[model samples]
Target: MSAEIILKANHISKNFGLTHALKDISIQIERGEIIGLIGENGSGKSTFSSIISGVYPATSGTLELKGQPYKPSDTMDAQRCGISMVAQEMGTLPGIGVADNIFLGREEKFTKYGIVNRKEMYQEAAKAMEVVGVAGINPADPISRYSLEERKLIEVVRALYSEPEIFIVDETTTALSQKGRDIIYKILRRLQEQDKSVLFISHDLEELMTVCSKLIILRDGVFIEELEQKDFEEERIKELMVGRKLTGDYYRSDYDGNFGEEVVLKAENVHIKQVLEGVSLELHKGEILGIGGLTDCGMHELGRVLFGIEKPVYGEAVLGNGEVIHSPKQAIKNKIGYVSKNRDQEALILSASIMDNMVLPSLSKISSAGLIFKGAEKKFTARQVDGLSIKCREITQDVKDLSGGNKQKVVFGKWLANESEIFILDCPTRGIDIGVKAFMYQLMYQLKKENKSIIMISEELPELIGMSDRIMILRKGRVQKIFERSPKLSESVIIKEMV
Candidate 1:
């Protein structure tokens, strides 16, 4: 608590048009401390982070760095002042090698007379990779060759190579697996030991409580409270973040009733290449069935197969009333919704408006007798926007400009409008705030109440334990064990089965 204050934000405020994004917020970041910036979706956290990281200039405020007034004009300016940020959406250049991406703009260090010094670049890249706990990635290899988790590591490495004194991490852990997160923690601990400052942002309260010494709460562009480590509680933090006390567990399901006589979805001996070997599963009405294992354990392949995204060599999925779907188009026509693990790639149409995206799934429904009903479409879109609590000035606004949580809600809304009987959600709440996560869980419970069966595929053990009425653990594409909810599953037990 006696640590030196490295950065101070005094009465910071910003506005977009007539809307206030930040309303007179003040906070101090101390050296060697891990501080968490907590808030709901669109609750000024991103705006505040952007202000500090030089993505935007504060309308009225003063930012002091080590007791000296600092105003950064751009990201490069912020970096020059010893401040750097690594945002959640991994922004590594796909076509370039790791070394090239690391020293992207500042290639002069690895250049001589306009010629790149490839040898020096590789050495620096290797050192940066090691510092960030990524050693297996080859400096010469293109970034496109890496996975999402691997690209996440590259972003961290890029920042480390820039030599930042105050590191701003914005929800970086949501993309990472538990093991990948552990590696990040190690790097943060090392930075803390060296008396460097870190502002950690994440939706996982448990992880934040374990790491952050101080927590700042935000609500609707207003600074609500700042709590010490002693005051940290899961319910308390969540309530503060959303300005309300949430009911039920982190995941909600009513386990008292049967799964129903009607089969909403049936995967009959589905196989995709050699990864899936005659895998079959049945999901009934009003059920939340979870599937989990390692990333490469064939769990993902199963979702793709069921959704008709993957071309199966053998077997098929049958909808309610015995309608077979051989492709995604057929599945869509059958009224089945799928949310992929890769939100950026598979789920969202980034360039389209939130309204356009939301109404996409139900275009046919809105079209009447070969005539498009625009008014009816707007009515449907409005209902979805309000139901999901999607934050945007208008449905006409591009989804690309919205926060990570809002983008996900748009994807959900797009599917929900179609009146889909079955839902397949793969890591639906990844890379978002806790308040948004709670909302996602609440939405799922609401859907369950409507007799909509869901298949949740996730790599997170706690999420599976929290939400699923029934859980299936797969190992090497084989169903190892299935656990029912009444038994009250534990993380350790599930993890043991997974390994």
Candidate 2:
């Protein structure tokens, strides 16, 4: 017997002002199947998913849910019709309790005579979180108390609470660590076992291959091709998505791990409460120092402490010039830059224009006698935008409107324009596509050649091996080992130290 079709999207097209976000596209989701959506940034992967989830109405198209005409006015309407989505961006709201975020719009169920039953809602919310294997999150606590990864899992709980037949995950896994990813994987498998459907959107091709049974490819808002599990090939999928064969090295070609003897940035016996304990490291000029560990292994905290975002309880991070770093403002003034792992919240001002964000770090350089120059600002912003190939209508466009890759470019461009000598990049390439990842790696290589220093903190072991001159493995608020860069450095060796 043939499998039942759960949802059908026909001749879908979407537009925003003069820009065509998605062209004519048609796809279907089948019961008991996992479908992967693959494409580069701004390729309409999220747009299509948004149309189905009722976040945006299609400019033209028709949708059939279980062979019935489905027109959802909003996300809640879609949820009522057994459709749910976990957005790529942060979806939970601050200044609210975890239980309130879980049952955002559907709080009517817990309403008794116009008074919300807080006790009953918290119980249900706790149960929902438990179902997703997320522990230690109190439903009564404010959502702001949790980290980005935990909040992502909370969004998962919210989506799963609806028990929708069609579950859409839009680049949500990129923000999660291995433990969090395993929880999502388990949820997807359980949904498949129950004869439900999933639409998995991701930039990680290897991850898609592992979790999805079939893959749909899109390029420049057009449907290019689709592939089954048996026909899946990395190069072929990349070609189909980008419309060209990717050439050149994906990472640094040389195995030589030589770096300057001069220490540019040093963390001297730094400690951050429970996060980092006696973490000491040296970032030399013209070096890419990769720090790797599990999600809560304290490497990220080390990065923040080094960048002066978090103060160490005991030791300090100092520069070769004997400048003591005490705050972010002082660090920036001393030619140090930081790219946060939580890009949206910490790196870029989403509401501001690209020009504003790009010129923020260089405002003093472009200003004279307490006066700002629009000409200088435009010139600076224009140079970075063109050099980085940041796709946008204009520099005046809002940063939030750009794709994830372009947003990251803006973050990089700001620091580059400021001429920062030392960079602390945390998860720099997260949620971006392969093409962009390659570009970022090349950029780092160029920075190294210019004698700039870098401290790259990441959760991915392969990236740590691929880019760093030396790899430092942290486990439970302590450095387990530091391995020099060599051709024979394998993930297995690094994993041993990290665990």
- Top lDDT prediction, candidate number: 2
What is candidate 2's lDDT per residue for 173-218, written digit by digit as tens?
A: 9999888899999999999999999999999899999999999999
- What would the TM-scores of all predictions be? 0.93, 0.98
How many backbone overlaps does candidate 2 show?
0
Name the weakest run of 10 consecutive residues (lDDT summed) in model 2.
457-466
Model 1 TM-score, all chains together: 0.93
Q: Rate the local accuracy (lDDT) of all candidates.
A: 0.85, 0.93
User: What is the overall TM-score of model 2 with all chains considered together?
Assistant: 0.98
Which candidate has the highest TM-score of all?
2
Residue 396's lDDT in candidate 1: 81
lDDT of 2 at 109: 93
